[model samples]
Target: MRNVGAFACGLLFGLGLIVSGMANPAKVLAFLDLAGHWDPSLAFVMAGAVAVAGIGFRLARTRSASILGAPMQLPTARRIDPRLIAGALVFGAGWGLAGFCPGPALVSAASGQPRAWLFVAAMLAGMALFAALERLAAVRAQRSQSSS
Candidate 1:
């Protein structure tokens, strides 16, 4: 039942992306372009998304569990640390360059877009690399603690 609910939600999200032209790289690039024929349509979409998410978060804050009876694991981090800043920069760079963030990239890839496939592959590689680097850092920290 949980899996079914998750699938339904994901399918709906993908459909929304497609309907909103978010899954189209050209549309996204046009939206990003500021000086040359800038398209502000995506800005409206983004604003709507932000508004909806804000309301959803506000409601979720009052709940202990999700509708699926699972624990509500919302983000707890509030401080804007260097790591967060760096991550935001990296994410923005990727989005600007490829015109496809993770969600839209996945939707495009599922629709058999070649560029989206490449983007998804690169994204996965970056995630894997980040995981490996984190593991290495953890090991170094553990060793340093043991030596101390």
Candidate 2:
């Protein structure tokens, strides 16, 4: 049942991307190019998404727990941290350069775009790098404890 819901959600999200012209990198890049041949169409898509999520979250907050009876996991990191700031900067840079984030890149890759493949490769590399750094930090902490 959980898998089924996840599948349905993914399908709906992909379909929404296709319908919204977000699956096209050109459209996305145009939206991002504020100083050039700027297009504001994607702004509407983002606005609609934010409005939906805001209202949905508000409704959900009125309930004690989720439908699965599990508490919602919300981020509590309000203070700006170097790691958080660096990660956000990296994400924004990737989005600006590729004009395709994870979702759009995945969708475009379905159509066999070589550029999408490149973006996906770089994105995966970034993810792997982050994971490796986390493991390295853990190992360093262990070594420090042993020495002390």
Candidate 3:
């Protein structure tokens, strides 16, 4: 049942992206191009998303657990550090270069576009690389602390 609900929610989200023209790279690129042919449609879409998410978060705050009986796990990190800034920079750069954020990239890939597939592949590779680097850093930190 939880899986079904998740699937439904994902379907709805993808549909929203498609309906809002966010699944199209050209549309997204135009939106990002402020000095050129600027598109304001994405701003409206973002506003709608923010409003919906605000309501959803408010409602979620009232619930102790999800419908699946699992406790909700929210982000606890509030501090901004170099890691966060670096990650955000990379994310923004990738989005700007590809004109497809993660959600839209996945949705676009469903259309069998080669570019979309390549983007998703690169995204996965980056994620794997980051995980490996984090693990290495953790091991090194542990070793250093033990030696001290």
Number of the top TM-score candidate: 1
Give me candidate 2's TM-score against the actual structure. Answer: 0.89
The TM-score values for the models, in the order shown, are 0.98, 0.89, 0.97
lDDT of each: 0.97, 0.88, 0.94
Please write out the lDDT profile of model 3 over residues 19-105, one tens digit for every residue: 999999999999999999999999999999999999988888888898878798766789999999999999999989999899999
Q: What are the root-mean-square deviations of the candidates from the true structure over C-alphas?
A: 0.6, 1.8, 0.9
Candidate 2 least-lDDT 10 residues: 67-76
Report the lDDT tens digits of candidate 1 across residue range 84-145: 99999999999999999999999999999999999999999999999999999999999999
Q: Which residue pairs clash within candidate 3?
A: none
- lDDT, model 2, position 10: 87
Write out the backbone clash pairs for model 1: none
Model 1's alpha-carbon lDDT is 0.97
Q: Give the top-scoring candidate (lDDT).
A: 1
Give per-candidate clash totals: 0, 0, 0
Which parts of model 2 have CA positions greater than 4 angstroms off?
A: 63-65, 68-71
The alpha-carbon deviation from the true structure for residue 6 of candidate 2, after best TM-score superposition, in angstroms, is 0.7
Q: Per-residue alpha-carbon lDDT of model 2 for 123-142, expressed as tens digits?
A: 99989998999999999999
